[model samples]
Target chain A: MTIVAKFEIPYLRFLDSEGKINKPLPHFAKNSRDLISLYRTMVLTRTFDAKAINLQRTGKLGTYPSSLGQEAISTAIGAAMQPNDVFCPAYREYAAQLQRGVTMAEILAYWSGDERGNQFAANPEDLPIYVPLATQCLHAAGIASAFKLRNQPRVVIVVCGDGATSRGDFYEAINLAGVWQLPIVFVVNNNQWAISVPRTAQTNAATLAQKAIAGGFAGEQVDGNDVIAVKYALDNAIAKARAGSGPSLIEAITYRLCDHTTADDAKRYWDPQTVEQAWQEEPIKRLRQYLIKNKHWDETQEAHLQVECNQQIEQAVTEYMNLPPAKLTDMFDYLYASLPAIYLEQRREVEI
Target chain B: MSEITLVEAVNQALAYEMQADDNVVLLGEDIAKNGGVFRSTVGLLERFGPQRVLDTPLAESMIAGVSIGMAMQGLKPVAEFQFMGFMYAGMEHIISHASRIRNRTRGRLTCPLVFRTPYGAGIHAPEHHSESTEALFAHIPGLRVVIPSSPVRAYGLLLAAIRDPDPVIFLEPTRIYRLVKQTVPDNGQALPLDKCFVLREGSDITLVTWGNMVYETLKAAGQLAEQNIQAEVIDVATIKPLDMQTILASVEKTGRCVIIHEAARTCGVGAEIAAQLAERCLLCLMAPVKRVTGYDTIVPYAKMEKHYLPTAEKIIKAVEDVLSYEG
Candidate 1:
């Protein structure tokens, strides 16, 4: 048996980190509508993140994780996916959820700790928010396995963080996905930090993408701050997955420019210089500058998009805040088709 | 009726359910080609093919987690965890997600799945081979916990669990897999998922138990019969629903009670049964309720297993204690 000493990370990107496309741009759409749409969604998600933090500070919402600087990755992946394909997102995938049809009001309600906000009716292709870390990878693999078994032509993309790669579920999921050659893509958002612990402390490996090589699959590393690069790489990987080739891991090297969640303070851990460096490479600004420089966007259009996004986000927040208070027993109702005796007794006690 | 061992009965149940419903599928480690470690799924691969009888990897969480997704997609999946003790690895999926899917989705989705594994002590197996953890599943709100005492009950309860429109954990007693034989009904017959059965009737004291412990309880009841202490025996086929009416009625009629189980004593099924009796039938009690349970500790390996299990003698001692009490 030949022991492999090393493997290479395969990244296919048309755009560099400086917003320059190395290859000629494809003749898809020059109307700038798509670019404007990406900008609007990113701004909306950012606003949502800020509002969620404010709500938590005022005791109006539960602990919330913000996707502050990772907007380009989520927006680009959402843009490249087909409607029939399924999206299994981690808790920090607010932009992806919004782009894939989850209402802002519903997402806010979920962050507010209401079960009704977890509703997944409109987007049948989207899974509920997976909060248990890397467990969603296994779910995505299962869905992809089912689709393969039934001879269906759909890809299942699962999103996870760098911390999730160290979890056993991540390995089990990818291993199964490889064994069965399922149509799935595992996206690892390497935000560099998992709460107070840094990514370097979590794994000794050089890159999270290389972990996929152990399962006999290739992976790529991309600049997560560039929307163009993210879209190009994801589109190729997703196409390869849908063609029945198997699974691929995409490690997007991004930064968590904000705290891990609203309940945390990054100032307690990271130095101010590191945080400042991350803010300089912010995904939204990089994409916005590219659009303006290419004459695809102007100051008038940017101002118009900002006003529209702000109005939409405010409306969603108002709708969420006006909803009725959640009931405690609502937790007991949907566990099974019929409640067991123990839950019934507990419900009765609560009623009394 | 055909007489068969508990292992054969479980195999027959899977075969019959697979034949009756096209939606029913089985998946687990070595469940297809190897026919399961206990041969509980023998001859299923030839009949159902690879799609229906899948041999999964040795990952427990994926086994249970994938079953939840399959059930959500309108398939009835019966997954085997090989042994009850290994079920702990998949407890997150069982207790948190599978049990809460229906409630979490507000009836929009239902996990019609069944997890089957052998539990209880009596066999001289290695460490982690024998465990009685029905109470853990019983304490969860959305799950149904079933423990059948005999081959016939095993067949009937397995069918009921497969047909039930919810998730159920079917605990099969491995110690008695081939030790006892009973005449089981033919295909399509099923016992109610939430009902209890009265094995014997008497008036002196009520003996409540389930699973393999039911045999020991019956033996103790027989020993009491010779001493003129007529003890009533009730087998709790369904542990979660508890069939409180049957237990409460028996406790009220006898005015004395003894709960038996092979799990740890601290928070076993016996504790829940005794507590329910105290809260519901305290006025009718002539003596305080007694309990016969295994000591609170990890199940020791083969040589000392008998000491760790609650036996007939232990039940007899608890009965004597309750009989001699003046309270």
Candidate 2:
């Protein structure tokens, strides 16, 4: 047997850095509703994130992690996923969750420190936010393994940050997926920073995609700020995985314009000029510019989009705040099928 | 009735369960081709192929975390941790996820997973090879701990553990894996998880123990019998959801109790048993409960392991002290 050339980083670009589409973009839908939906979701996500940070400042929500500049990656990847497919996300994928099916109220409730936010919806399609970093990668592999064993034609998508690639679970899960030929697509949102540590301090590898080669898997690096590029990369990866070809890794190279979370201040560790330069490549702005240049959007439509996004966000916040306070017993309810004796005792104490 | 060692009995139970249910899968290091380090998973790979009997990397956390996901997806996974001492690496998954998945999912998911490991001292193996950490699991909610002392009990309890709807930690004593032999029934009926079995019944004293120490307690009881001291031996198989009624009844009848375990004395299962007996059966006790357990020190290498574990002599001494008490 002979080894083949390393997998080329797959990509499909519609817009260049100067905010110009290479050619006339195809219209998949007859009425341009699809494009309008995508734009609306992006604006809604940005509005929700800003509201979350404001809530955190007002002591309404707990520490919030704002996905300010990474909306394109989440929106595009989430759009490519089928409703039946399982999505395992890290803490910063609130936009992805909302687009997949989670309501804005539910997202706000989670950041407000309520257990109900993590509860499975009536028709559960995704798992709760896994907080232990790359551990979710292993779960995604297992889910995909189950699908393969049962001969199910569903793909499992796992979303992680660049910092998670350094964890042991990431390597173990990817290696297992490769060996078993399980149907899994790993998306790494390389935002260039892990808390206070920058990407340079995380690993010497020039690109996170190259790390996948060590595990005998195919990989690609896409411009995460480009919505169309992210959607095309994920769509092809998902298609390959569903075809029984094994796992693939996509590293979305983006930047976090905001602090890590409300609790962190990035200015202390990162150069202020770097932050200023990254803001120019914001994902939402880049996509909006592409739409305007293609004659698909104008200032009148932009004004209408802002008004629509604000109204939707205000309604969601009103509904979320009006809901009853969270029950303390919810903490112990989902821990087991039968309540263990210790938790029973704790519940009794809480009642007292 | 064919007699077989504890390891053979465990292997037979796995073979029977896999044949009975297609959802049962075994995954661990060397369990597929090499038949495991102690050969507890021998012949499983040949019978179940690579999909059912997966050979995984040496990462314990991955093995356990993936099992949790598999179990959530409606598969019964039996994971092996080469040795009980190495379970520390996977403790977070076991404690945080496996034990809480059923409740965390609000019954939307159940982790019917079994973690099988060889535990206890007397193997004379290197450091970190023999450890008895059942107490730590017993303290956690939503998990069941099963410790079978004989071949027949191990087979029946293991079957029960696999079929149970919750996560079960099956601790097999490596010291007695090859030493004990009995006729295990071929039929797949499992013994209950939280019930105790009386190995030898006597009204003079109640000796409660499980795992390898059960044999030692029985030997001590036999030696006491020679001295006109009749002692009852009860094997408390499941540590969590303990059989308190059976124990309280035995203590009430015998008027004295002695607990034995191979784990360290501090915060061990023996303490919990003693405390429960004190709270429930205090008035009936003729003397304070006595405990024979290992010291609170790291399990040393083979050279000094004999001094680190509890022996028959220690159980007999504890029995004598309890019998000689005037209060």
Candidate 3:
């Protein structure tokens, strides 16, 4: 038989794990302010994650997913998109939400079991964090279809975990995006473990990014711990999408440096040696090291930034705790455009 | 006004809505070029062109999910499933995302789309083609389950489902898609949702039903009227926010009730109406509520379908049983 088709998967990396330059840097790297800003956002995410886990442990918050080692993936996607573009996030995309104008107090309030926490005043087009794995991919495709139908220049960005690639929703979503040639970018945070199921057991597709090739799109992999590499790949993909280049998938290789959530104990399944090795390549420390070596940051600035983050987190906690409780009618109020007669009568007994 | 079949009425209503509102679009497998498997969307693609009338892949989950995304973005998408049984593949998107988008976002976003599918056992179709699973969609809190029994009702209700600002499960009865014809005015008018239609009025016994079972109940009511037992017939157009007021008011007058449906007897919509009557209208109920429904088994293949569906004779028997009760 004659040859049918051939495809290749690409990989991208800039700064290595040891703060050494692995390749020539992009134009954005020359701007020290941009790098410093990205670094600051990663630090803010780490601080916010620690406080959220502490609150969960103290019984002040609901179950929370930490962005511990996967900060670069979320932060880069958040910083790459424009304001009119849509952002569809997975459950652990709090870092991206923060960068997209969602308040720290709003995040804290949502984790405290209040629905009002998701009411983002600045970004109404941004979807709330989806808990059901890769379902947001389909929503992203739909949003992209709307933009394409209306002939708009905006793009949509969606993120999911490594395990989400195993679900049928993921394949179905990408299939439609490819067929329609929609303007959306899908990023996979391959942090090695999907809540105790290792990446080895997820699939044998060689690499998750290669899955895009079968759906008729460009697929590439990047070093997720290196923030510079993530930003470069996402910037290129977002630009291509805006120029009507259809969809692209980026598989960011990283590790889960901490437990899956406060409700989980990684020691039960993960090997101690693996965890120790992963800690050395975490995202925040790599970015911090890159900033310090480049003379863009120093010890005094780091100390001052830590103090400010602590004060801001404390203020958010106070505001979240002092807010009035949600009304009981909130359950019935938002269920439909207008309350039907049946619900109106049922709402009487619950009224206080 | 012109005489048209139920399926033709569906096509006209869709065309009218697409012509009136630029945001309304159609998508499903074989819906655009093939005009749908049942010809319910026949002439939509030729009229609206390919941009508004989309023909998606054979992925039911993406079809439902993409419609939700479009609705959230201020577009009114009307998606169709080839058959009701195939809706199982899209149930996760329906129950989790489409039904919960409004409540999940705290009213910041709403899913104003219609998921249309042909259901019930008839026309000698295959195993998966014949199903009456309206109860499943009705069980979802944020969904509105609407079914049309005649041509005019189909036109009016389809228009209303597209205009409503929430997700609606529009289940059309395949058994009666072209069984009869009626004059439906293409005036772009929409009937109020979440209300029941009183098809026939009497005072002896009330026969409450929806979808295909409405035909059987009306036939039984006519038979009862000949035997000096004038029965009241109520067609429950919307199943979810069941206009229990109309059913309750009819029960209050007739003092007896019997519900007929083609779905399974266990946990069917008929059970909900029966339970509600026991709770609110117990004082006026002269006899225990009776249910005439299909068996608690999977809808059988073509040969056994006749035994699986609720017939007019069975509904008449149920009405007679309720009338014979002296307690």
Candidate 4:
């Protein structure tokens, strides 16, 4: 009998939870500039996430998903892509959306139930966040097919949850990308839980990254709490896709420190000891420790950054509250390029 | 100008559009070298090259989603599902994303793609291959549902669907793909959408139908004419954004109407047309408006298909019932 094939999922980690450098630094991390910017953005995201949950608690905002421990994965993908490339993200990718020029106010308007919020003026090419699980994976493959067809260097990076990898849309999407050799990357934020369903129950696979192997592409894992490791994985994958080498999948291991959303309470289904353990390895805290230990940040700078983030978030909240109410006709206007004659009376009858 | 079958006319229309617009591309299972299961996309790959003509994997959701993405990026993709029964796997994308993207994004991004599939029962194929569940798409707000019953209409309407600026669900009636031939010019002309084509004019009754049922309805109209009933035949080309004005005017003159369709009787497109007549032409309708449609059960297998499809005989019976009504 002849042996068929062999595959292995490569893992990477630059900084451990104790602020110790475990792996050699990538080019961007060798200096402090990129690391500082990443830290700043992660802090911004963490601050924003807290404010959003607060608003939901006070009945000022709708149900919101908190990216408590997974900021590094979103921030790393956003920072790694070029302006011309596209990003197709699932819900809870505020860090990436913010870096791609989606304003905090715009994000607020959307969560507050306004369609006008999705029309991004600065990032027109990027897709609006898809709430349906795993659907964006196929859209990213489609967008990448366009880039491949036009002989362009643009790549598409799509983010999904660990549970999404169980859906057929995820497999079908990666299959097309692999077969067509499309310029795209599938990033799975394996945050250990989907709402109430644990990762263990989601799939029996040893690692979520190995799912890409079935599609004939490389797959790997990273310490998602380590911002540098997340950034390094995206950089390598994005470069390969841009050069038309094909697609890759990276399963970033992290944990959802908060409940699934404001509508949920993790205390009901989660273990108290497990939740406390996850907080120690949260992305923002681990990265902040790494920055301080590496001498790139200090107590004085940390104090100033916290003050600035709060001020910025307060300004955005004010702008979001002051923005004009969404017009009643907005629902009818964007429905089609030109409204058909039959809908004229129906459009006229629309009321608030 | 050359006479061709409905399927041949479809092929010609696709070739014309891909030739006229470089942005137009085709994708589906077995669409490239295999031409297509029905040959409607034959010769397109050879002419347009693989860049514009692609054979996608056998995943309906990906085909629908990928085309939406491509359309958002300014490519006009005409994606075909092998069969309408197989199309349900992609219904989530069609309903949740393709139909909602433009409206949700406030026109910043739009999906201007076409989802084409062979629909309706008649050929002695499997049960899934024979369905007229077009009402499912018609119920979607942002999608335009277009069906062509004849060769000439197929050529013109398909071209218009490819050119329409919104997402379109273009269902071709497999029952009539090769049932008839007519001289259809290859001219790059498109018919108007969201309007009904009034095929014949009369005052005794109005016979309204679409898809392969158009043949059965026309036959009923001809038989009604022999009886001096003088039925008006309306070919409702586009089911969504229905042309109720034409049907209203006809019902006003005829004082009676019979709506024909092959989908299930409950909540079918026929029900929509019947309800519209009751709303807009209630006073003009001197008699009653009746619906001649398929049964409420699942579209049956091939051997039992004829009993399920609305026939010219059933349509004639319906017209007679409406004509005899005193209300």
Badly placed stretches (over 4 Å) of model 4 are none
How well is each residue in A1-352 modelled by candidate 2, as lDDT tens digits?
7887645555446655566666555443223566666777788888889988988899888898999888888888778888878888887787778877777787788778765666656437477777778888887887888888888989999989999999988988888888888899999999999999999999998788877787788888888887777777888889899999989999998899889999999888988888888888777776677677767888999898788888888898897888798567766666655565534767876552
RMSD of 3: 1.1
Candidate 3 ranges with C-alpha deviation above 4 Å: none
Error of 4 at B294 (Å): 0.8
- Give model 3's DockQ, 2 decimals: 0.84
Q: Clashing residue pairs, candidate 4? A: none
Q: How close is candidate 4 to the true structure, as a TM-score?
A: 0.99
Query: All candidates' TM-scores?
Result: 0.95, 0.93, 0.99, 0.99
Tell me the lDDT of model 1 at B138: 88
Off by over 4 Å in 2: A1-14, A22-33, A122-125, A325-328, A340-347
Preferred candidate (lDDT higher): 1 or 2: 2
The number of clashing residue pairs in model 3 is: 0
| lDDT agreement with native, every candidate | 0.84, 0.85, 0.91, 0.91
Of 2 and 3, which scores higher on lDDT? 3
Supply DockQ values for each candidate: 0.54, 0.52, 0.84, 0.86
